[model samples]
Target: METDRQGLFRLPFKLPSSAKARSVGVYIAGALYAIGAWSFFDAAIYSRKANASSVHVTFVDWIPFICSTLGMIVVNSIEKNRLIQDAMGSGSFSGSSSMAWQARVILFLGFALLAGGISGSIVVLILKFLVKDFTSYPTLGMGVNNVVGNFCIALSCVVLWIAQNVEDEYSYSLTL
Candidate 1:
């Protein structure tokens, strides 16, 4: 990026090169993941030790968080290079369309699980907390925390995907 050094025309911030940016992006994603997990765990602890209300964090609340975490694992486990190589028909198994098909199937399932986790969180919030008229913050916060945690997990995954691809893009540019 070129800088315009003619006085006040300069931008406030500088953009990093993809190679330089990947590390920072990965760190940010990891931080978000940690914060998300911490937030959900806090809710559970509060429910057990501090909460005075009838509401509690049971196995039901854990289901959505588990689903989202599993989805993240499934999604990140797929080798992106394989998808690209299969698309370009340049792999050692280039003649085998089944590999690509299987990859796509797995990718779809992972995304479905991710979406389902978030949706399930909302359903629990409505059906369990909101519908019962538990409008107080102490009880309502458990549901809210679940939603936030699941959302952050999804966001962390998105950031990681972009961060990983940035390195690949930088390498590709160099090859060209």
Candidate 2:
């Protein structure tokens, strides 16, 4: 008698498995929320500081905090939606088994980190543009720090995105 041979598993490289994407999304959302919260607190503290005028804090610090908080909420919603889609096996996972959902979750987290970093950079840029005449302010160093921080965030996001792609390949190989 002759036996037929079959491949162990089909590779999913075109897009991350839905679960992985969702997990990454949630992680990103959570991180964004944390950052936004921290920013809000920092703004509040700065507003109370004697050196920083209330008007400056309200126009510069509070405005950025509000923007970041709003943006984070949007990110959270996106992540939640992705999670739902993954849970239902709605997108690329349609008709697929749930066996790889965990891996999908991990990938989703990685993506979230990437998204958060990128979003942070954008927020920083907005703040930088909104604030003018740092030299006239007592916190010139702080202003410079913000610029550097934004650059770092953008770089981190790119790195995370690349890592996610590489990680996916490695995970796929392990399963193979």
Model 1 poorest 10 in a row by lDDT: 2-11
The most accurate candidate by lDDT is: 1
The positional error of residue 103 in candidate 1, measured at the CA in angstroms, is 1.4
Global fold similarity of model 2 (TM-score): 0.34
Clashes of 1: 0
Q: Identify the runs in model 2 with alpha carbons over 4 angstroms from their true place.
A: 1-13, 18-21, 50-56, 71-133, 136-138, 141-176
Per-residue lDDT tens digits of candidate 1, residues 119-176? 9889999998999999999899999999999889888877776566553333643333
What is candidate 2's lDDT per residue for 62-163, written digit by digit as tens? Answer: 343343334333333332223334545444454354445544565456545545544554564455533543454444433433334433333434433322
Which residue runs of candidate 1 sit more than 4 Å off their true CA positions?
A: 1-17, 90-96, 168-176
